[model samples]
Target chain A: MSHIVVGIAEFKFAEPPHKLVTYGLGSCVAITCYAKEAIIGSMAHVLLPHAYSSSHDNEAPGKFADSAVAAMVQQMEIRDIGPSRLIAKIAGGADMFAGQFMGSDRCIGARNILAARKALDKFGIRLVAQDVGGTAGRTVEFATESGLLVVRTLRGEVKQL
Target chain B: MGSTPFLSREQVAAVEEIATIAAGQAGNALSRLLKIPIHIGVPEVANVKLSEVPALFGGLDAPAIGVLVPFQGDIEGNALLLFPEAGITELEEMLFGSSGQAEDDLRLSAFAEIGNILTGSLLTVLSSLSERVVVNLPPFLVQDMAGAILDAILGEVGTLSDEVTTLTFNLTGLEDASLVKSVLIPGSAGIELFLEAAGRLKTGR
Candidate 1:
């Protein structure tokens, strides 16, 4: 099976026997949405909660939580994966520099996590699992065949959701 | 989130000169601490898209140890010292002077001290060059994905602009040939002040 790497502020879709992976998610959120019947999966690595304005609309849509979820859902729909058949898993959104307390708005990891949840709720997509909100960076891999979301931490710890 | 370039060629050259001096000082400091000669590459200064910043030290997903020192006052920005995961063990061994593996906390502390000296030396040179007082906050250490560490720092920059002014330095002279990178990210306001000061110094105005 081949693995497609989704970089920061990016997203990708994959089918059975393929994996969608994103690396080093800190203060950023990685959301994986999978449809069992269609065997379709998509992942987004969102850098912030919201876009700055319409000017930034031309840039990567997956760079913001709101747009990322919307885009992912649209991509899945193109493949005949309906919302009713979709479940989501998330990883990353870590406060890598804790106690710095830049501010609530600057608490980007937590804000990204909250934004992803809100976006998912807006689409009525059920969040089945998540590994988020900590002080470490995480690499997430989502397999379309097994529908497994694997999370690997910088400290060499691994977990499956 | 604006795309305007922050620093001009002249400004970038000025910053590069300051970084070279700072890197020299930092190399000397490290050499003293480790009692081994340290060599630094020519400093590079550039203005780049925020998305492109994480690619400098490999990629966003590459495991790294980042030492961050935030500075405010006459200037506002962050100084980051990045060490790749493969280099950390060698660095720890060199710094602690032990063959056995050192503890995590100890390694972190050593890295923090290295960051402090490097950042402090840079800020001092910048202050002297601009004749302005720049204050550095306490240094902290984080070991994680390079992308994530950058994201945490970029959160603030994200609200301001889509591009960042960066100063980078490469270090060598270790037995293992481990690569170390030092990056200085100055906020918009800080870059403006720095450019203004640099321009004045150039024209003697």
Candidate 2:
């Protein structure tokens, strides 16, 4: 049976799965990595950029982008997924409530998107596609089997990234 | 009556204060900004009884407030913002200023925007009130049976048991008492700082 993994609040997974999905990504970003030949995939639903800065370390382990990405890559490597073969795609870095948060200043969504990019770059994973940064919150689903990424925004449109 | 778990006196007080401030600000802002007559309800402070909560929705057993569930996260030590489902109707009427059947997108968009405003407003207020408070993520807007909904949310955290204290409020939008937004500070973090602020607010410190 193909494994379907759901990234919980602080749960991070890297495995050869058929699909990885997370729902109700409000101000939380989900990053997905897939390797075609190996059919291995991993996903992280990160809430904060840095674990040390935010008090979320006590509650949400996957909240920090730095740690979450590191953890995701580590998981991928453990499953024999090579970094080079992995194509990266991301979604759900929506600013959630951007207008009231003063756009970029209080914009954690943009920050998450930037941090994800930096982290992926640091790990040598190429970003193939992204649907990030908007006023709307989104739910992202990744199909590791086909390496397809789909993003659905609340009260908005669903797009393939 | 099951006593919710033990939150430090400090944690309990902080919940009341933060909920008061958040609900007040969110309601006022939604009313002023959206002209929807959003009214923040009176704050009700109580411990989060996981057992009672299961009975609240449909008998979904959830661990602590932060535990992750099928689709949501920890829920035990979380606070709640409860609004009558009918309130949605009233809110639609007020937001539209005379509405028939509101479009699905319109309804969902309105909730999303309102959730954004509420979350942002609370962050600013808390930041101003406490030096230690830090908001990591934006508040998520959701609607479900109070129990199941909260269960989904609580599924992400560790067991909350009696550690979580909640402050609930009601809002009146469009003279029909519609819309309820809850700003929950989990029992895990943000509680102690809030209590200290409340003490200062109460003692005029």
Candidate 3:
């Protein structure tokens, strides 16, 4: 019944009876991977779609879609849960401001969503459900026991996926 | 985060001074609009890692209404006016003269206009102080988690540099005396030009 809070550009994993949660996902995507029989759950709050290289930079692998999905796969493997048995659910990737900024890439929310989907496909993980692409922010909670993904919007609307 | 400091102490002081002036002007403008006295707190200027910015306004999950405006010209950056959930109802009542109007588009538009005025006033002060032209884009509104809104704004800059120069303003004096915060994030090039201008103002060169 204990809850683990994940921050921006962060990730966590847990077993049955534990919950993983992340708050305020705007333009960023929160990916939750769980294996029901194995009682394993993993969550990542990804900030960007791709990873940038810098000599002085040491960023967390969970910060980008490509690396985050890969890292989650590795963590699940360590817990004896294979990629084929994992099911993923995602939420958040909101276009907070539309038509205000310059460039197509400025639509970071949409980009993050696409990237996460692509990464999931590359890893052969099935994305069972997602609530994304809107002008609102979302908070997500994932329970490992029953594998329920709960999403709450800023307008106080709740949906369980 | 990068170990190298982007702005020196003198530069930070200059930025703080400029922000203080802008906050004062913005406060006056807001007070006039709402017909209530408004007071501006001392401006806080600092270099913060993008990942850490959300913590300033509570946390990522904290519900808030954010009005974002981008300014371009001699100086380029984004200004954000953040209203925490606690005071949103009261503030809405004060602005629209009623409550339970959370989903009213008219009220939302009015709120955006208020953001426009306040941000414009701040930019005007900065432009006058730096002797440069700064123009603001239309202000847009977003009601969401503080972290999510900031991620959308700072995503580009986060890749270029691990940290950014952020100027924060705290305002008080509303009917409920609720605390409201405004954050200004200047682009790297903009900050460079601003520091140069500040140095010129200081040395009279």
lDDT of each: 0.78, 0.55, 0.77
Interface Cα RMSD in Å, per prediction: 2.5, 10.0, 1.9
The lDDT ranking, best first, is 1, 3, 2
Model 2 misplaced stretches (Cα beyond 4 Å) = A1-11, A14-18, A53-61, A99-105, B1-10, B13-87, B90-166, B171-197, B200-205
Instruction: State the TM-score of the second chain for every model.
Output: 0.82, 0.65, 0.80
**Each candidate's DockQ:** 0.52, 0.03, 0.55
Model 3 error, position B171 (Å): 2.3
B97-124 per-residue lDDT for model 1 (tens digits) = 6783678788778778777887888777
Interface RMSD of 2: 10.0
Weakest lDDT window of 10 consecutive positions for candidate 1 chain A: A98-107
Model 1 docking category: medium
Q: What is the lDDT of residue A102 in candidate 2?
A: 36
- Model 1 residue A159 CA deviation (Å) reads 1.9
lDDT string for model 2 (A104-130, tens) is 343556767888889889899899998
Kindly give the stretch of ten consecutive residues in candidate 3 chain B with the minimal lDDT sum: B174-183
Number of clashing residue pairs, candidate 3: 1
- Give the top-scoring candidate (DockQ): 3
**Cα misplacement distance, residue B31 of candidate 3 (Å):** 3.4
Give me the candidate number with maximum lDDT.
1
